[model samples]
Target chain A: MVDYFNEDITSLHDKLVRKEISVRQLVEATYDYIDKTEGKVNAFITLNKEAALKQADALDEKGVDPDNLLSGIPLGIKDNIVTKGLKTTAASHILDNFMPVYNATVMDKLDALDTITVGKTNMDEFAMGGSTETSYFGKTHNPWNLDKVPGGSSGGSAAAVAAGEVIAALGTDTGGSIRQPAAFNGIFGIKPTYGRVSRWGLMAFGSSLDQIGVMSRTIKDSALVLNAISGHDEHDGTSAAADVPDFTAALNQDIKGLKIAVPKEYMDEGVDDDVVSAIKAAIATFEKLGATVEEVTLPYTKYAVPAYYIIASSEASSNLQRYDGIRYGFRAKDVNSLKSVYVRSRSEGFGDEVKRRIMLGSFSLSAGYYDAYFKKAAQVRTLVKRDFDQLFEKYDLVLGPTAPTSAFGLGEKITDPVTMYLNDILTIPANLAGIPAASVPAGFSKDGLPIGVQLMAKALDEATIFKAADAFERHTDFHNQVPAFKGGQN
Target chain B: MISKEQVTHVADLARLEFDEAQLNNFTTQLDKIVDFVDQLNEVDTTGIEPTTHVTSAVNVFRDDVPQKGEGRAALLKNVPEERDGLIRVPAIIDKEED
Candidate 1:
């Protein structure tokens, strides 16, 4: 078995800085781990072995600045975030061989730091599903249990971090894509406020809701990675110009007297009892720390899911309109006319879940139903945002379960689209509210699968997310436990 | 309230070809989904301003700088046929299959 102590990035970085380990050694060990687990986990879609080694050799030969936060780190990136000269499929058949000519803003930022991006990870095609099962490449199974799914469309990133394939990874959350999978996989993941990270090259899902997120084994690692990637970029018009605090610097903030609100609505009705208990236990830990806790109601919380589907799908339909098989991606043969090309390419390119979304989105945005569905959902979205605003006035942050349940059996709900959609029932409200939320593993379920407790902060308040998650991680050993697959010989 | 034919029509518009069984399945599934969506009608939205974006960002117009990537001109160029910078399709407006 690989030594988890040495394998962890935090420890690896410490060792590398202390001259106990070399970048070459760290890179080789990472490759060895990936070689052992890739066949079973299939977390990565693209691993540039030669390029990785070449970079590692350069880092070893020239040496890196010891003070650099991620000087000699290896990381995974979700394929949707473009990397110049690398094939970025977003796990869709359409872009199977498409190579990006430009790096995404986040990639450029990280590249400036010289962080080694080891591979491109898997995800649901066009990021349209809750499980990586929708991936055209194939389903990515949970590392904890091969029979179960890794939550998605950021599943690959979450699983990669959980399985220790990479120190950390970047994920995009349009509607709980990052946090839900992180919750399911039992790792730390944060979807920064909508404009916290630039979306310059990410294939748009819900443009308004989508934000680049970070995933890692611990909250400190997540914050370190977030600090590197969070900032304003002129390329993304939606990028915030507001000042961003040093997330890593604020990691040790005290939780005492921090007003935490437990949304009673999230605990009642649809939440799984075991998951709720775990969250309640987590909240109790906070209370024991001298933090004030109170019950708050986001009355319109029930409407969050429907409002989310309508708005996310509507944005998806418009965003996905770009994939017509002409510019790039898979183009169908024997298409006599352009119309046939558009229809056939998309119909064949997208998976069933994606098609379902496109159709629903089209209907919602269609002329007749616009006011009835799309418009109404938007109005409710405001009410949902209002709930967060009202609650934030009284509380420093809001806490809830990331999902109603935990990592389900691989094919359990895949056949039933509604059941599959309901997986993000809890996470969707944060997306609708446009808040920054992070999922930290609370505890294990009865079946031994991981359940996540989420903390959401007001827009651009990543400091609060880090503060709460940091304090929580300091209290729990859950972040230190690696999945069974991490046993090197697996 | 959507019929099987309506589903088929929308499928055709989306250019997806489903078999009879899949069609029937999609019809039933979509009917339930549409019914679920119909619940939006229950909330009295009288005088509630419809919000398409939560941030209230409007027109979000980036400067219309000339660029070579998939643009309006490039998209119009891909349509089966175009007349004076517009997509040309069979006139479905007048041929309503009532």
Candidate 2:
């Protein structure tokens, strides 16, 4: 029996190409592996067994195609992304049975490359919260410790990859949704520049900041997935006109004389002492790799959390208004009037965190307060962008801890939304700036929770992010560590 | 701190109907969150422009030619109430002024 669980994308792809393993065999292994771990992990909201098998049989008969980057590898996507004929819930009760009739642009790209969709992973309701605890489907526990949260709203995708449920996965980052969870789970994830990937089929949480990205076990795997899914799409007006590069070529690039700016403010306050040390160790490793690391100030760092919440929630409040009971999704059974249909359906359908965000967002964007709140946050967002832009002219990348701390206990911060919001303090700035950033597993804390170091580069500079990440990963064994949850079972 | 009335008004604007308990909960949470973001007021904007999007992605127009989209049947598939391929909804007016 081939130990499919131990292989990453690159090795797995090689095995498929060499005809050493059959696609049907891999699909079966993936399902069997998912069945074994899913009870403990709770990674997927819906599994695509019937469709995956049909795709797998066709692949086996047709033989592997090297040009098809995904070939036979299975993928897990966050539930918010639309999949044609597949139910996409966004881990919310409102979308509980909403099967998208059209594939999202990214989904079309993945389908073209012949990757089987293993399932849709759970997430925070409407991508509103940090911890997966806000998911209507129940929390996806961190594979490292069953008691800890897999940070969200891309939590289930991160946990899925970490637990070896899927070879690679897709996640959307609004405000650190992708990077923070990847940090918590100790895997690799990227939030490509805002316009780098199309948002055509993604159910928008924050339209301006949301960009779909890859979650995988290695930097190499992430780059390949990025290579496959990224590029301009006419379906999304915000998609970039910039040319896509062969990101895999970025692997093994020399980081000599690379200028990396480590934010001094990120290491202070809410960041834990252990997380600080892990990031510091990453800085030392960069120095050893011949890259210059210096402490620079993003002086307005304190304002990121507040600015992000206002701006993101404001946009979310407007974007989510489409879910009125009239079109699709859940409807209030007893509502006679149109107004009641809108109010009652939304009231009953949305989870608490989603409701809270909608309420705050609507209030901020409401008549008199728009200038005071929404407009003010936008101005602050300008300062945050300027800070990174100015640094990028002199530095190749900005380095920081992906989150303030490692994965916390599941029930710990659920009570305080403020603290949960604070978990994104470090990562929110990247989204605000629309820069490409990646989380590379840096080290483990004393408590055994994974910590990740973030690498951010100027807009459309995913190559440099990959270069630095590849350098850091070549030296660290953190990405190679499998959680005991899987090791014991296997 | 945000008042219950403000919360109620905002809830109405959001089209979300909540009961008394939810009103109190939302008011308390919104108060703390609003106060937290209120820190932005102290930062002087001077001559700065608000950034709605970082990419500065300009309007991308397609030709007037029509394109394929999710068809009528697909669009109506998820609707709770539908009639003859059209979405069924409550009447717009209960009683006319005239």
Candidate 3:
């Protein structure tokens, strides 16, 4: 029997092609793996077992084909992306029973190439909080340590991949949702430029910042996924029309003469000492690899956290208005008036974080406050982007820590919203600047929690990130360290 | 700092219901957050144009044609209350449905 759960996508694809394993057997083995590890991980909100088995059986009958890019590989999808006939909750009670009638364009892109999606994984409620602890379904634990949070709102997606629950997963990033979780879980996740991937099927958190990207075990594996899903779709007005590249081709590229920058602003006092040392070590590694590393200043780095919250919350307040109890999902009881129905259903259906964001957004967008808060924040966003534009003119990429520290305890910062929001400080600049960024497992903290080193390149320059991250992985074995699962009948 | 009455007005605008305890809880928490984010006021943003989106994509229009996607039956299937394939809601004028 194949150790299906432990294998990466490339080798898994090779084995299927050589008749070393049948697709049905592979799918069954994955199910066994999930049963053994899921209790400890709590990654999925809904497992697609019945349908996956049926599909795998049909795929086995057709015989394995390697020409198909994904070719029967197993994947996990974040809950916010819709799949026809399957429940997509965004890890909130309001959408607890919401079933989609159509698959996301990304799902359709993967489906055409025959990738088997195993389940919809859990995440922070409506993709708001930095920790998965805010999810209505309950928290997703960091696979490395049960007490710590898996960074969110793509926490489950990163956690599942780290624990070998799925080969890879799709996650949406708005202000570092995908990268932070991937860092916290010691995996590789890429948040392509804002318009690089279609957002048509994604649940909107911050419309201008949100983009669907890959969360995977390795940069190469994620590159293959990016190859299948990146392009313009008429459905999403903002999707970029740039030609999709063969991202996998970038894996072996030489970074010998690549000019890179290390942001001085992010290395400020807010960064944890252990994380700073790890990222410094990473920069030294890049320098040793023949890449030139120098200091660059993004003078407005401190402003990203506040600006992102205001901009994202303002958009979220507008986006979440569709969840009134009249159609789809959960509704309130004992409401006599239409106005009461709107208020009661929403207040009861949403979690604390969701409510806070909506209120925050409402306050920002209110008549008297718009010009001072929302408009000022948007102008700050322009300055942030201009920072990137000026630096990218001289350097090929910029590097920093994905977060200030490694994954913290589950309830550590949730009590104070500002403290929780501070976790996104280093990662939000890329979102504000509309650039592509990625997090690769750099090292571990003193407590053994994983730390991630971030790499940001200009828009549509995903190849540079892959090239650099692939180089780092080749020289280190940190990504190979799997969390020892503990709990529930295994 | 935002007062309790102002907090209530924002919640009303957001269409979210809250009891007295919740209002108090939120007021305390939100005041700290707002005060924290008010640091943005210190930056010089004069003559800087607001960036609505970071991309150059604009004015994209798709062909108006029939497409096969999710149908009405599946959509209406999730309604909390329904009648004759229409989603039912409480009366807008404060009248309860029996």
Candidate 3 residue spans exceeding 4 A from truth? A4-6, A486-490, B66-69, B95-98
Candidate 2 lDDT over residue span A1-490, tens digit each: 4454578776777888888888888888899989988989999999999999999999989988976657988999999999999999999888898989999999998898888999999999988888889998988988998888899989999999998888789999999999999999989999999889989999999998898999998888899999988999988899999999989888898999999998899899878999999998999999999999999999999999899999999999999999998888999888767888888999999999998899889988988999998988999999999999899999999999999999888889988888889889999999999999999999999989899999999999999999999988998899998886632131
**Where is model 3 chain B poorest over a 10-residue stretch in terms of lDDT?**
B89-98
Clashing pairs in 1: none
Whose DockQ is greatest here?
2
lDDT of 1 by residue, A1-490 (tens): 3343335556767787777877778778888988887887888888877787888888888777677868778899998999877779989987887777778999888888778888999999889888898888887878888777899999999888888788789999988999999999999999998888989999998887888999988787888888888887878878887887889776877889999999898898778888999999999999987788899888877777778888888888888888877666777667656666777888778887777877778788887888888989988887788778988888998999999988887778877776777777778888887789999989998877898999999988989889888888898888777677522232
Score candidate 1 by TM-score against the native. Answer: 0.91
- What value does the lDDT take at residue B83 in candidate 1? 80
Model 2: runs farther than 4 Å from truth?
A2-5, A486-490, B96-98
Candidate 2, residue B59: Cα displacement in angstroms equals 1.8
For each candidate, give its TM-score against the true structure: 0.91, 0.98, 0.97
Clashes of each: 0, 0, 0
**Pairs with backbone N, CA or C atoms under 3 Å apart (clashes), candidate 3:** none
Question: Which digits, one per residue and each the tens of the lDDT, describe model 3 over residues A211-320?
Answer: 89999988889999999999998788889999988998888777899999898987889899999999989988998999999998999999988999999999999999
